[model samples]
Target: MQSNIKPVAYYLPQYHPIPENDYWWGKGFTEWTNVTKAKPLFKGHYQPRYPADLGYYDLRVPEVREEQATMAKENGVYGFCYYHYWFGDGKQLLEKPFNEVVESGKPDFPFMLCWANQTWKGVWFGDFQNQVLAKQEYPGIDDYTNHFSSLLPAFKDNRYIKIDGKPVFQVYQPLDLPDSKVFARVFNDLAKDNGFPGIYLLACNVPIYWEPEPNGFHGVISYLFHSFRFREKNTVFKEGSFLGKVEWKWNNFLEGKAIERRKKPKVYKYEKVVTKISKWPKMNFDYYPMVVPDWDNSPRAGNSSMILHGSTPDKWKIHFHNAVNYINNTSPADKFIFIKSWNEWAEGNYLEPDQRWGTAYLKAMKSCL
Candidate 1:
């Protein structure tokens, strides 16, 4: 069952307290805050998912980071694709863990960066209206040069993950850029100028229908949830009492006026979603399949959350096997698979040990690999 497929799990570095987070969410605010406050929206819905082995570890602790690296490596993950945030003019958020990794060179894990190039809003806290925390700005070539220069140190680090002698970088929302093709070209040239092989830019297949153009990117990585072409037709909301229904209708009319809408969460069948993703048609370019163990963002979005119900480790294993088979049969040369996350607990998507499943998800990943 040996396979050449390289698995890279997307890592979120929001577990530690940062000034921006403190300002936006309050003092001592971190992702744990959201995770702790999460409540189950319906029957059988997993909520307040507690950390088992890791035990709600803080990212500021070096030992915690080392433990994460060890766990990931042991579970057959090839590397971590950390979510790197850089607002124009070189402003960055949640960079302490990765910066330490670069400076200390501990853990010795292979890693890459995916620019989460999107504006920060209050949507996570159920404030979907007019609470712009940080706006994503592309200040043209000068800012781009500064951005590349800042990453040069990490890019040159020996631990950086590369493909075919080129350093790999992913853009979470490539289409959001002023001109994605131009951005890729500049970054590729910058990598070359810094005395390395050209960059292997990967565009995330978010916005579902976004077709990759003749951009400078080498390939596309199918971000599982985002690539899901789920329609409103397939979604169903649980019905409520007559008054509740009238209130819901009224709330829908007053959607923008409220801090949070009191509406039933949209739910989809996980098994059917998995089937659709596993059977996705092959594309012309390098399309790296992504496997999501489970997803339930009710913690972040509350009642407005979109959830995929009924995701067991067994079902996840089936999805993983399908993705692996897809790669082996269609794109053997690329041999890459992206897991939606390593630890996005607030979204109920993680591979880390949890109270209910313990290390079952990791076991499934290791077994599938």
Candidate 2:
């Protein structure tokens, strides 16, 4: 294992069927429904990327989790940061896989939870608003405590990823989190009470300029997807300032008028987005750099998808190399480099072996490690 450089990949837990999805989508529906139906919109676009070794296994199967952990560990991935969904209070979606991992203790792989605190919409079936499936609601102090209480089992698990004896808890939409400081304080207090030093709170989907500590977060992991990476089309520069040293982050997406209002998929070369985005103006001490293996959400968004024209294993090697170096130079506490995902088949951004490239992407990352 690389002690100084930890590569943690985001793991999506939407593979197995859930009652919520069955009702919202269709009977016996999972992410595979979207993946198998994706059709190429352009000539060279890769569509219907099929899994090689893992097949379309259900997450409810313990053997599948074991195999995923084995693959991840063999390729130098330090841990799997599962996308944990908490609609508020003790309500959650996609909790089965990780819950089993915690209770069964079979894989024995390191992991952490990232609260996907967002409402479930009908976007899956193409209806954005009218069909409200699961709306996020933050009740009050009691609910917050119960939320922490529910996670106590996973937090106490020996396999839970931690820093300085503190379990790392991530919030996917920290910007949407009401009273982040309070949330941090409450979670930290709860952790201390549970024999932990404190909870290492990390925030995601925030601007590059966003500071973590001030906002009660230990650090930030900006999901620099090629689609939303603040650059040329929306970037602004100070008069006579250095070229790469100027412009904004995704705050424009959050603050300014919406940009994803396109009728067609927005496509860009992977080389361009990775090359330009990796040229950091300056190393951010409070920020952990992220690398994306590939991206194409057409499987989910149809024509409105944001697609990266070409992303091969060869390109991933260079991108991964840059991110490893970037993380290596950061403070030891911030030495973690995040991969966009281990498996998000619907989004076309996953490191898991696919028929298109097999384990080539993982092999490329192995070279870096």
Candidate 3:
């Protein structure tokens, strides 16, 4: 399992302040603002989690990124999948840290980019979804060409992670992409012209059961450890489904409540969800699987976010152990175990050491690998 598996962590660049974030969420608000402001919504809930090893450090400091790279590299983490935002026409957000990394060549860590092409909304700051923050758009070939040209430097860097001599570029919402096949072709042509094999287009978490072979993507990263599980259109909540649904019903009976609060919080136990989420259920197409250390986004979403209650290093270790075996015996060649995050403090989902769990999660991961 260790021989075949490569762990790539999802890295968030929101630790530093951007003009948009500063303007929208106050003068100096960063992801840590949300982290330090969270309150416990239920009994035995952990909130306001603080950093231990890394401290409340800012990403602008190069030493902070070096420390992160050292921690992840030593713990068998393969690369950083930094979320790259392009809100059409070359407009990007939260690119400072990564730009500095590429230019300075300090940590020398392997990295790739995932185009987080979703529209930002006020819902990110506990406001209604009607509030538009930034809209994602694709204005055809010229915009796509410009987008590819901007990242040519990073793509050409020695630290870029690749597959079959192709630099890996992820599409966050392949379904949302207009003329995705054409988009892939353009990137492929651009990569080839720049003296490379091609672009490895990896679609992350596409809806409508996206198939890679048909959709011009080299592969798909399965977010098997989703924070909130939803269904297709016209799908109804049936009895005896996810454990959370049953528990909610039972709790309603005991409390004489209807379990119908608008935007009511949905919580699922990490242990129960583990058993259900571990296996891939066998499919014709192969995929790289994801492992979440823990998740509780109430910090970011208040009472409306999904919480994975009772998450522990032991449980994550167990699930990861199963995932390794599952991938080796079944899935594709690379056998990538894409951890949902390297550091996303606001969502309470990260592998970085916090005040509680101090390097225990890292230890668990190393033990498995």
Candidate 4:
């Protein structure tokens, strides 16, 4: 493994049943519900991705969490950035796994948190219009204070991931925050007041055009893969007939409407997408690159999924190596490559062993490291 570069994979803590999940999706609802029911939308489309080595395990089991940590450690992953969701007014979902990790202190793994500060919507299940499960609200200073206070335990934990003596906390949607600058100032001050060195606040690169500014964040983690939409209009019949033009226009109109209906998932060439990202212009600030092994969210979003086809272990290795090389040459002193995920089976983007490509993606990551 590379000594300088820190490889932190995003960990989704939705394997266990939660009250909200039970209410929103029936009893015993978890990510596996969507993952297991997914079907291929087109030819050669990968679907119903199933776990292999780990099997269909529940996160409530202590041994399951331990095994995950062990596998991550063995595959050259430095740590996990657990997706931390804090709906306004202190309401949180999927807190069982990380909570257990914090309280038990078992596995002795390095970790951090990325606040997935977004409102819960039913867009995934084709209810884009009427379902608002949990709305995100930033009720100003008091809420921010409480939020920081709540995270104090994890920030002070010995196993927390840190950079330059400061515990790392990432914001999934920094721009969504009412006032990001205030958040950074308040959180940083809280860190110092709590007797810690400081906080390394990272802003996720969501908007794609976002630049590193005085937004209270120390750096930006380039999560660009999710933003790329590579599907082009099918124009093969554009010049042949008037009927073709009308049909094309109707199809385009339908697709535009589908944005709201959450229909028609966009598919793209994985190799082309990776190559395009590798050639993207360099950022001016402390920027960390990211990589996705393979992405097919048909499980979660159904036809509304964004699928990246033809993503083999070989292709992943190329993408991973390019990210490593980019960070090494551009910002050698600040080495961080955030993989999109460790195990997000619903999205089909994970390093965990799966039935089709058992440990192949993990091996590719290790090769790059």
Candidate 5:
């Protein structure tokens, strides 16, 4: 019998309720001045009253929360892998919905953290478009250490599943803070100090290519290859050592230059991250890769630096099936298939049903698994 482990959805709980205005910004305090000042691109996009000003950021609304839970629970979704954003300081935003999910006494499925350590500015919380709070300053190790210390209780909870007995920690921007070596040491040591054996640190290797160190730290290495090129046909990868040496050939960007002023590299280059990862023999690893509907964050970045617009729910299923096939064929039955998100509005790659095709994406996810 096929293992009961249905595919897992990585939910990046933006928790931005549907905004009244057609504009993308959710309701909250927005710093239009700073946003417009950041770059010329924000001229028309950055408005004084953004989506945040409309109260869409409030996930506490009954209708909003119900929609989220119901949508996630719909169509045989195994569970949600919440992208837990930590400020690495005392202040943490958006913990409310997650807290409610856990403490609401509702039947919540398994969830884990992706530790979005990227700098958060008003653009997100409507604080400042151009300027973000510089939290990860020099001696960044100390900042994250303190943040982890605060999150110890949540880290140890049973809901927080582990890979090979070590708690899984996903880093949105691994290179933002200290160098890779320091990050590796701090993560392992801190995790062990917190009574856990070690941490399975997963990083986003989208723009930055990652190769496991010859003597790399123990953890899971994941690559967020969200593009149509990777999805195209005849992309054959000779299965082998991706560490420091893996190659690929494809057109990374689907859209043209004038549309978004984002230049698409003629030769879309990338290491078959998973292919390389599969070659590792001694290390314990899990593929926490992502499936994207499309890559159009034009709502945020006016000029589409990276665009992939032709991805439909049906098209996305190919990646879904690819992940499932990979896991079933390669890893054991219990392996987790990490998705981009259940709801990432800015980027068009959300599983949540939208006005364009209500429930089409979620249904695709359901029927596939």
Candidate 6:
């Protein structure tokens, strides 16, 4: 392992599933079913396959993980950061692969969890897309303490990565988190209580929207802007009737207004957004961001949602190279580089080997990592 070089880590959620429509998207919603009782959220798409199938299909299946491990070893890549989701109230989501790695033998790579404590509503399996049934709200410092008390043991695992002699832990939606200070304090207290000395609590602030104000807790925050949709549209949805298209002339008027609004520049201001977040003394980098190939959740659109059209592998490669160059030239060598995901099929931003592109994205990652 290249200890001196900052590792390139992936956010690998073990429960990321290929939806067979096991949840709310099917006949479960039709009026014909008066006798039907309970149903899965994505009832139209996929079934709940074994958790092992998730890792097998997405990562370990078809020899992808083996291939990745071989490639990482060849490339001097340090580790893969599995997004460990521990339901603090005694529920473990997708602990199989990690357990297997530990039981069989030590893994070739080091790993750790981001403490995806935000909530559990089953989006992990592609069943619940934007249909968040519940949220594990910030349960205050006490809950975090209880949560970390268990998590500390996992941190002690030899596979966990450490920064400055401290284990690295990530939080997926820190912005959604109600209190940032209390969160930081809880993490610190937990680390001290565990006698781990220090903890690197990295917040996965993808868009840099909830940029923190410059404070001592800046070290706890890490800027990793995840670009799910970087594709530009010829038209903007400027002031359309909120109730999807109405009468013909009314729709034309809405279309004309939208066209007229096009005079404004569509270029995203990354520097400004990063600047806003960086002002808080947070660990801001010129993010070599990842872009989703596409994001058309219309499969779940029986409930009515906009379709994300137009995403090609070639265009995705452009974003991938941009990320690589940004990391190679822009980001600090000593700082960690992150990818949006190894698997996030629902939103369409995935690095996993998919049927559409095969290992094209993985090849792209090789050039980058």
Find the candidate with the highest lDDT and give its number: 4
Every model's TM-score: 0.89, 0.91, 0.90, 0.90, 0.66, 0.59
Tens digit of per-residue lDDT, candidate 3, span 269-302 = 8888777767564556657777888888777778
lDDT values for all models: 0.80, 0.80, 0.81, 0.81, 0.51, 0.46
Which whole-number lDDT from 0 to 100 does residue 76 have in model 6? 43
Model 3 pairs whose backbones collide: none
Q: Provide the lowest-lDDT 10-residue window in model 3.
A: 252-261
List the candidate 2 regions with Cα displacement exceeding 4 Å. Answer: 128-130, 226-232, 235-261, 280-285, 332-334
| Model 6 spans with C-alpha error above 4 angstroms | 1-78, 86-92, 99-106, 120-134, 206-314, 329-333
Which has the better lDDT: candidate 2, or candidate 4? 4
- What candidate 5 gets wrong by more than 4 Å, as runs, is 1-6, 16-57, 102-107, 121-135, 138-141, 193-195, 206-209, 213-285, 332-334
lDDT of 5: 0.51
Q: List model 1 lDDT by residue over 157-241, tens digit each.
A: 9999877768888898786788877887788889899887788888884433445657677777864455353322322343244
Question: What's model 3's overall lDDT?
Answer: 0.81
Query: Is candidate 2 or 6 superior in TM-score?
Result: 2
lDDT, candidate 2, 302-366, per-residue tens: 87677878899999999999988877766647478888889998889998888878899999999
RMSD of each: 6.5, 3.6, 5.8, 6.3, 8.4, 10.9
lDDT of candidate 5 at residue 153, scale 0 to 100:
64
Worst-scoring 10-residue span by lDDT in model 6: 30-39
Provide the global lDDT of candidate 6 against the true structure. 0.46
